[model samples]
Target: MTIFLGGRSRADTGNVISMDRFRSGRSVSPIRQAEAYWSALRRHGDVPNRSDIDPRGLENILEYTFILERIAPGVARFRLAGNHLSRIVGMEVRGMPMTALFSAMARAEAAATLEHIFLAPAIAELSLISGTNSRAVSQVEARAILLPLKNDLGEISRALGVLVADGPLGAGGLRFDIAGSNLRKLDIRPDRSPAEPVPGLAEDQAPIRRNAPGLRVVSRED
Candidate 1:
């Protein structure tokens, strides 16, 4: 597997501090709201377990939601997917590599991001576009979210995800063409250390709080 390095220790090899492709914006869709709801469940620095997810709680966004299970280092497969996800591919998406939904060109990066999410226990958000091809002529644009989840054993090898298409989808089988992606590493460590003070700020001066929660990858096509 390809390895990415960050400034921290080997123990943190599973994590990254940040990346350049991140952007901050308003949360406009039901999918984004779902992510916020998931965030609200984290109490006492615990990564929410798959068992903790209640399908009814996501009824509004349920069609866009999904769950993934890590099968190997840096690899995850769909354990369950929503109707909206199945409709995009014109078939059930369970048991497939999460990359199956991505365009050929974007699959590698998508896989890498999944790895980052699992190993680093990060939250990943992506802006995606689907290719125009036979059976599906019109292109589709969408957004996707992947958040880390713990398994029954408490290992951070599961993910909770959601995909929301911005426009009407073509009837033909469709796949994603990644446009941009952002990753935010969560500090779910049990200790939950306080953030260090920024330089040049007075001890009494409150540090400017930026809502940035992640790193990112801007697609060349964008």
Candidate 2:
């Protein structure tokens, strides 16, 4: 993959690989490829809708691609997820909240990020580290990118994202350590001015609810 960042092209690393793994023989992270697909669909000024996404265009990175639908303030469920994601979590993850993949302490931050993605309608890139449950030995470093997407009703209530780890995820529960994140508003354009509306609720606030559904593992054949 040839990475073209900062208006320059770097050496082509391999058939399929992310810029982050320039030298590693590991499979491509898919974040970059996914971003390209999203950008291409953004021919109009508005965020692309779930229907705009073409799975075949994402063939190479399809295993790491996913679709999220917002269910409430600061909350989203996996409407569709790929095999690569299921591998990381050790089971089928459809219908699960995005935060279910994060460590206990990092879940609050994850929720905040999700809210930001919808309200601010921004793009989020996160750095993550994961470790095994029993030994606590750090296992892998990962990267994720969330791009805003509009639902069929034209509300920014959906997002397209890709997440990948540097190494294999072995058995047992694996939770990510939130390292850092970067968020960029989708409306930022040098030729235009800020126009998106501010969210009614506070940035860190989560909606109150009773008996929120928990994530469960289910079997599925691809």
Candidate 3:
């Protein structure tokens, strides 16, 4: 990924991994990808019925963050420019809303993408920074799509979005850590809730003793 933010400056960034990963139904944290596929199926102003959604597609749309809580219309939070994020802007956001993930300037950009997924209206892309506080800023890429959910009466209900980030995906694997290596991960909840799970492990395997539905465990590729 290459980003030319203010015009004169350009930066090399992460890849938008192929949509092939969307086919992995057994995989965890594929919510975003699944949502995109749903939106695609109902391309003519039509929304895919959740039942009509392929198992693989369905798996890709559930964010580990939301799955663990089993909450709909929830929020995912993160630091916009922490060492882990390694952006020009540096800040800590342990429990901030996912909306805090971008700057005001970037919000419109980010929102446009999210709305497509949340509102089931569009597709968007992003080039973000990694390394929360490490001073090592690496560019990452994100591609997302949104799909709409309809109720029994055909009223639109929920919106599903698929998100892909390519690059130094994580800043660490443990929860509530201040500084660490960046890797691909799902933080499990927007509140940084006391119920938060260990970063890289499945709820079933994580050392913590939680009896929730068991959120998926996503592994970072070596």
Candidate 4:
């Protein structure tokens, strides 16, 4: 996979480190581990299937990992989330839109980024910063990665992700702004086509389901 570091912009002035540097810095071990696991699952240049994920494979980073289900264009919700994610938002995050963790101004961009991952079937690594007004009140720095996955029907509608933060999570209800992002398109063989647009994929809005005691990997039967 090719890696590119994004340049600092006015909005991301506080983001001094780019994704490439962040990866090399080796501070976010969970992100790296998750990427390695996802990469190892690929066969014949195709994305891994959701059912193929075994919680044991991610035991080390399970608390920082999550699964997402695409529900609409540019929209996805957490199918499962680890404890660290709940701690960040001060609530269980299952069934909540992924953008809920982002600031209002950042949601649009975050949604677009999510869409690109599913539509292009690409892998994305994002640099995030969370604090009051995105200026680091708690001085939290985070790295997140999104790896596409296929559903039981063989459609690219799921994702496996990892989010790790460094610094004191002083308070609950933290929201992050995207500092930088890098995307690598997957190599889909001519025998397999990219995911097609599915109509009526949006589910009815329902209450967030409470998770069990720990991280649970759903099988195809569920």
Candidate 5:
């Protein structure tokens, strides 16, 4: 498997951290953990307004979750997730344009990742750092990813993101897992779309059933 990591010790090799570790280190998959998050939404018997989600829950998931915004035409409200592969951080991010979260280069990197997600009809993962405000770089490190969520129109609508604050230094393994669930919840927009994302990026070229859970890819003409 392709290795995605922060600063890991050799012991971390072959030792992937599962989602069950949020409280105590346990073996769990991102999707399974998201199952708990979705149950929270189910409890509300509604989409659980962003305001309703507890900040603690968001932070817990964020430690090993994925999230994103749909502010733009192809994005989500503020930040959202598959509920299986990610968790929420501070919705303090509400109303804040994604660009405001990072530097010029960081913004460009974020945009490029977003563009790839749009083009491929798939998800894109990456690590993030808050700002240099912290004298210790490790204190502000945040690893995250951008995932696409679609509306009824068969076009991208909302986005799913996962964020984890890596203290002085992050972990050496993937904290969460990605599977069939996000395959449907996330997509990579082809470079050629109404939004005119960055060009020449190849993305997820598979068809997914959005109304239900679990994801399976079906090849489609690009």
Candidate 6:
């Protein structure tokens, strides 16, 4: 497997890997498959709704798939997660904050990156490294992607993601550090309508005042 690590300018053409390479291989990368699935759902540059997702579409990569719900600024908790994530954390990870998988030093950045995904409503690709301590038994590298999703209420507070790690996962829970990241802002067409109407009640029409300027208020019973 080709591990892409280190600093590469986002503008560099080499930073982008073609999906064709995986097509030529026996097994395609789960990350690429997840991305392709998400991209296919987009219509006219609009973000896909969470309801539109179907597990059958991601059958091959479901083990690496997850769904996140934004709870607060820069914070998100896993709404649904797969076995691969549980294996890394050594526990059921559903309902846990997504930052739980990151080392203390990396959590802040991870949270910030997550916030950007929902706020900018962008797509993010991240590179991660774990088990790099001197006493660690093995080093594991990973690639993950975050694709924004709209909830039933039409709020952009949900996300669909996939994380795929390469290398032997050492015993115990693993915490990864952010190695690199890239963001692609969603291209929302100007003509696209708002996901939902303005919150609260609709505007009320003001009562008209008579031209006499001395209108008196009277109860109907009177």
Q: Best-fitting candidate, measured by lDDT?
A: 4
Please give the lDDT score for candidate 5: 0.42
TM for every model, in the order presented, reads 0.71, 0.70, 0.36, 0.76, 0.41, 0.74
Q: In model 6, which regions exceed 4 Å deviation?
A: 1-28, 131-136, 190-222
Query: Candidate 2 vs candidate 3: which has greater lDDT?
Result: 2
What lDDT is obtained when candidate 3 is compared to the true structure? 0.36
Off by over 4 Å in 1: 1-27, 191-222
Off by over 4 Å in 3: 1-36, 39-45, 50-97, 112-120, 125-137, 151-153, 170-222
> Clashes in candidate 5: how many?
31
Name the candidate, 1 or 5, with the larger lDDT value.
1
Instruction: Pick the winner on TM-score between candidates 5 and 6.
Output: 6
**CA lDDT scores, all candidates in order:** 0.74, 0.74, 0.36, 0.82, 0.42, 0.78
Residue 222 displacement in candidate 1 (angstroms)? 85
**lDDT score of residue 52 within candidate 1:** 87
In Å, residue 4's CA in model 5 sits off its true spot by 12
Please provide, for model 6 over 1-222, each residue's C-alpha lDDT reduced to its tens digit, 9 standing for 90 to 100: 122223445555465443332212322378779888988998777889999999999998899999999999989999999898888777899999999888887788788888889987788888777835512367666778889999998789999999876656656488888776777788677555567657686676789767657776789997
Worst 10 residues of 5 by lDDT: 174-183
> Which prediction has the highest TM-score against the true structure?
4
Report, for all candidates in order, the number of backbone clashes.
3, 0, 29, 0, 31, 0
Q: After superposition, how far is residue 169 of candidate 5 from its true place, in Å?
A: 12
The residue pairs found clashing in candidate 4 are none
Candidate 2 positional error at 26, Å = 5.2
- TM-score ranking, best first: 4, 6, 1, 2, 5, 3
